[model samples]
Target: MSQTLRVLGTSVTLLESIRQRAEAELGIRLQYQVHDTQTAQRIAVMHPERYDLYDQWFHNLDFVWPARAIQPIDTRRIALWDEINDLPKLGRLHPDDRLAHGSLPCDRLFVQPDGRLGSRPGTQISMLPLTHNADSFAYRPEHLPAALAGREESWSWLVDESWCGHIALQNDAAIGALDAALALQASGLARFDNLGNLRLEEIDQLANCLIDKQRHGHFAGFWSDDREASALMLGPRVHIQSLWSPTLMQLHRAGVKYRLAVPKEGYRAWFGGLSLSRCVQGPIKDAAYAYLNWWLAGWPGAVMARQGIYIANPLRTRDHLSRAEWDYWYDGRPATEQLPGSDGLPLIDPGEVREGGAYAQRMGHIGVWNAVMDEHNYLVRRWGDLLRTAR
Candidate 1:
């Protein structure tokens, strides 16, 4: 009987190349279940037996860690533990940014000697840092009128009356709320004291604004999966919408011209990593460890870099890429030659510069990280109401 490891995560981590490579190299089969952020969190917490590992954003630690569904990962088990970026270890990427704003990587990341998750460094960690990057909306340049050429990009455009009924928004509440809040503030609709963790009243305000916009036909549609998001961008002709990096690459590869905006309010940053399920043991547990190590071995990171996702340990990925790939993806220079997407086919044209400039410049502009608010339950209920009415 062949060994199989069950993993649950978002579509980003379930790439075909990564899976095939792991299987071929590690001699284990992988059964991957894809879910939206909320659904993945629910499964990881409520039914830990269904998966051996979970890859998700740090914001979800609020729920999953309390449920005790995952076990601490010993740094010694990971092959390249020392090489991982210090941004998470230091808590803040830049001196000026608050610890709360940059994915909160320091809080509850390490597993302490007492077996509780904490910021103080120890032998164990809650998760193996994987891929992370800043997120922003994308728009079709040709759709804009010549009169508005070179207009500064802003999240407020999502709620602008000019694009009414032609805009799309993400379906997930945790992220969608942040995006909406950013837009609400940018558009002068309303403001929140803390965009990452909204108060109940602030949640209500944002939800009410979203409902009003939906009722007035402001949103063309809401998308949950990458395919649905891609459809919105390529078909039915959405002018602007919230986008993931991979989906933007998909649109670009398909010959659709789109521009990823570096919004004036700053980018929404996030960090994601892999966690072991409490149920994994014996051979399956060993296979899970192998898989995690394989993820940090550089090839997977190189594959993801094509889609604009940065790995936790960039030095490892450096070995797997050509100088040009490294320069174009990390240094934010114009591509000297055509570069392949995750599929290993040429996607980026020569001389095209990456949006948002270099990695440091991009990370420096982070306004807020994705987060689950203290009032997440209420936020979800209100978000559901908007979805139902919009549909």
Candidate 2:
């Protein structure tokens, strides 16, 4: 009899292809409940018993870890733990690379002897770091003002009054607040001591500035998922906005002429991985471990790489990708020929190069990571006010 592993996460990793592959290879039945970031976090924190594993971001640990919703993963159980790169293990690919601000995965990776999460190395981990990338907004070059066509792309553009009424932002509070803060700071409208974690006054001041913009019709709408983001970007409703890697691939397949900006300020990065639900044990727990191991395996990482995410074990993933894919996506070289996405559809043009260059260069430029702020509760309420007032 096959034991069912109930997995909860966003559509990014919980794809139909992945589910089918896992069941066929691991001999376990799988059940997936995919939700947007906000809803998934709410469920994982409040009702941990409903799922066997939680596939989400590291920043989310602030909520789930404190709620005791997840169990630490033993490194020995991870088949390819030794092969994993230093980025998640040490918080930087190279020792000299400064850690990006926010809730970095390494900062909360290990399980301390006292049963709390910390950066110091240990045999147990809060989550197995998997797919990750540096994120920035994209825009349709043709839609931009002619004067700005040759100018360097920037986060400040998100706040520029010239682009007001045509901009959109991702709707989640934590991620969106950081996006807005970066924009505000870049445009010289506001300053923050730390972009990742906002103080109470910073939250209020940021919200007030955004609310004022909302009254003047600064935003078209806020999107909670890729579908809404795609709609806003594809239609004439929005010219530019915050975007994820997968959404960019979708746009490429649809033949949208968009530019994923290499922002002057730097990218807002994120790391996504899987964690064991607190209630999972015995055979179900073993199956859960198998799933985590499967993610680090070559094929799965290749699938995610087609959409621009970098797997934690890059060398293993490199084997599964074609030379053109390796050159274009990882090495930052122009594509020798059109490359196919995970769905087998052409996603890259022959002469096109990735926006921010090679993996090392791109990862080195991270400004702030997606985070759960210290004043997250207050931020949420104020964000809600911004949303309500915007509509």
Which candidate ranks first by TM-score, i.e. highest? 2
Cα lDDT, model 1, residue 302: 96
| Each candidate: RMSD | 1.8, 1.0
lDDT winner: 2
- lDDT tens digits, residue span 119-210, model 2: 99999999999989999999888888775778888899998887889999998998998999999999899999999988999998999999
Return the TM-score for candidate 1, rounded to 2 decimals: 0.95
Model 1, span 1-391: residue lDDT tens: 2898988998987887788888899988988889876688889999999999998988887788889999888788887888887767775557876454524776768987777777899978888878888899998887875645778989888888877888898998888878888999999999889888888888889989889888888989889877889999898658999999989888998999889999988988888889999988999988889889988899999998988999988878989988989999999999999899989999999999999998877877888888878788998999899899888
> What is the C-alpha RMSD, rounded to one decimal, of candidate 1?
1.8
Instruction: Show where candidate 1 strays beyond 4 Å.
Output: 94-103, 113-116, 145-148
What number of backbone clashes does candidate 2 have, counting pairs of residues 3 or more apart or in separate chains?
0
lDDT of 1 at 29: 90
Worst-scoring 10-residue span by lDDT in model 1: 97-106
